[model samples]
Target: MAQSFQFETSTERYRDEHFLPYFRNGVTRGPMTAETSDIDGLADRSRTPPTVAVVDAQSPGNVGTIARAMKNFGFDELLLVDPPALDPDGEAYGFAGHAREDILPNATEVSFDHLVENYHTIGCTAVTNEDDHSHVRFPYSTPSELPDRLATVEAPTALVFGRERVGLTNDELARIDEICSIPAAADYPVLNLGQAATITLYELRSLTLTDEETQLPDLERVRAPEPTIDRVYDQWAELLEELNHPVEKREKTMRMLRRVYGRADLTTGEAIALLGLLRRATERPAEQ
Candidate 1:
């Protein structure tokens, strides 16, 4: 890869005449990690190709469906979190069909903490919004929006799928970096695991790859974690209150600001600048 990071939207290979395609490009043999036994088939976990992580799933059939979807979408790394141990001879193989032996056989089982510790970025799937406004998983992004949201992350990233029945717990969702939702018919919003996985993978593939001919202005990209964003928002809240902004509107105003900052996708420096701006504007004896 020309750049340290490789970007691919979905199962399709993004090939440019001027740039080497990741799928067909030089894959020089590399050494494995010290913890190599736990992670399968990857030397550089940081630049993990698009991956899928299953959480507490019960169905072998669904896992098979997911594996088949992975094959269709060009995803190879699969992670399982407390899911029913895969039955190799079961419907999983039947559904995986061609990918049955190759990708499915290598799926790794890890803890929720393991995912948080390893991947550079993590996205969890959900059909409904969490009731708590302050939940880390809140302010969800659509599957189609995910690739753009994570365009800068060169390290390994994963899209996590929860159980068919209840989906991800708030705690599980908390450990993730973002939520990728599938917008659907309001009357029946949710889809089955297989359907959801396929749609998500397809949208991920559908993103237009940037090329030498592509017209775009590159900005200063930065990585700001949720915790930092929250701290900045809290400082903003103090500023709003100092200015006597109505109590009824405080939460709403904070939310709007969060959306503004979140959309900007500021780096640590950018976030710090904004936080300092608010403190300076609201400087008072109490605040000082």
Candidate 2:
């Protein structure tokens, strides 16, 4: 036999508080549109969409605007450090426009050091430091040059922005691996915090994920085996010895030779062909 249970208190109040109501299309309680994460598509990309880090921002509105810029350029991850007081109904969300739900609500608060330890930090600056000093450095690549440069990076990257008044400190700049400055004319230079972020994201738009529609290559050749490369090196060493090359310089020469071949990323067939040519060249000594 089963026992029946009854609740004396009303459960109707809980429906509107937590669950989606059966009939009402309430603005505040309505279904929120979410960004669909395309994991498979992201895997094909060489680099991830950079996490935007705002350091010591004085205004909440600026943060929201930055998040809006990120959504426009297909970036989602945001990191805030020493930010101003944020209010849901404040100008922060108002400035966010449509990206309010996408970026601001999900924004992460993290320490500046945490971003340094995890992702490759790209320091954003308007000032160009054209020096060879260890502490002071020029950008590794300009905005237009970033596509080619960042294409080879297969790791997580972050773009760090500083406060409105004074940009990133010298200590912060020194620790950064790379720095990027938006090229501006001398007559009317220096854009605002939001402008710089928007421009940077526009230039780096290629790194963002897209629809999984890119076709794969038909055939892919594997690299030459380690043994094949070692054998080729051994043969080259024997040829160098037979030529009476300077013994003192041979080791350095061999290392350079290794780098030359390594850059080729030779296949087994190509390695064998190169090894055969070395044998022929060694067999004939000056044709004397």
Candidate 3:
């Protein structure tokens, strides 16, 4: 006779790491939306690990896969910031299997800023160096840096990954405190969204201790939010437009500005400082 199985309630699913509970008659079965209560129950029991947010991703399959990877890697929080064409519980659960439906039912849908409000440290991964090196100047941080920095963390941290196509917008990246990238062949630099999430989580997972050990970076190292960068850039753009400066000159000046501040990787405080400076500098010319 075939064995019988039934989906667990929300409370039971949080602790269930594998899909066994959802199997019916010894067959793995996909849960319909009604089963989300089980996943919710699971979520209540489990403490969220650092969240991994995939922003503006286009493929639902990839989203499901990433959630699966997160569950495999022991990350509890899977956030989707502005994803396109997603049916959170329907299509994604098929890919997540039974182990990680918490991500499916309760996947936090938030703006980058909103996500950061709860997280103390946010790391963003980019495909290319992209003329900015605030979070990482070296190709990779030493193994020591990972555990040591992660150890001191007092609040929830988020590993923010970009979209499948363009990756994190400058605006999105700007909001993060640090940036990370997987070492890929130069010929083709981009990794799929799922691949990037898996690798990053893999690297981070290796650092956990029997006792939680997460390092906090010096406050100065944090980068300003992407919106702050947008505000600064917008100011610069407005100034150039107001001056009616030659396009080439404006472009050149903006490039130089990027080189200076982009390398410094301004923190939240630092960005505010710079914006204040711009406001002062661009104040209307005093009458002679």
Q: Which candidate leads the pack in lDDT?
A: 2
Worst 10 residues of 2 by lDDT: 1-10
Q: In order, how many clashes per candidate?
A: 6, 0, 19
Stretches of candidate 3 exceeding 4 Å from the true structure = 1-48, 88-90, 128-145, 207-288
Decreasing lDDT order of the candidates: 2, 1, 3
Q: Which ten residues in a row have the lowest lDDT in candidate 3?
A: 135-144
User: Candidate 1 regions off by >4 Å?
Assistant: 1-47, 130-132, 206-288
Error of 3 at 219 (Å): 40
Estimate TM-scores for all models: 0.54, 0.56, 0.49
lDDT of model 2 at position 281: 72
Q: After superposition, how far is residue 32 of candidate 2 from its true place, in Å?
A: 24
Worst 10 residues of 1 by lDDT: 15-24
Q: Roughly what TM-score does model 2 have, to 2 decimal places?
A: 0.56
The TM-score ranking, best first, is: 2, 1, 3
Candidate 2, clashing residue pairs? none
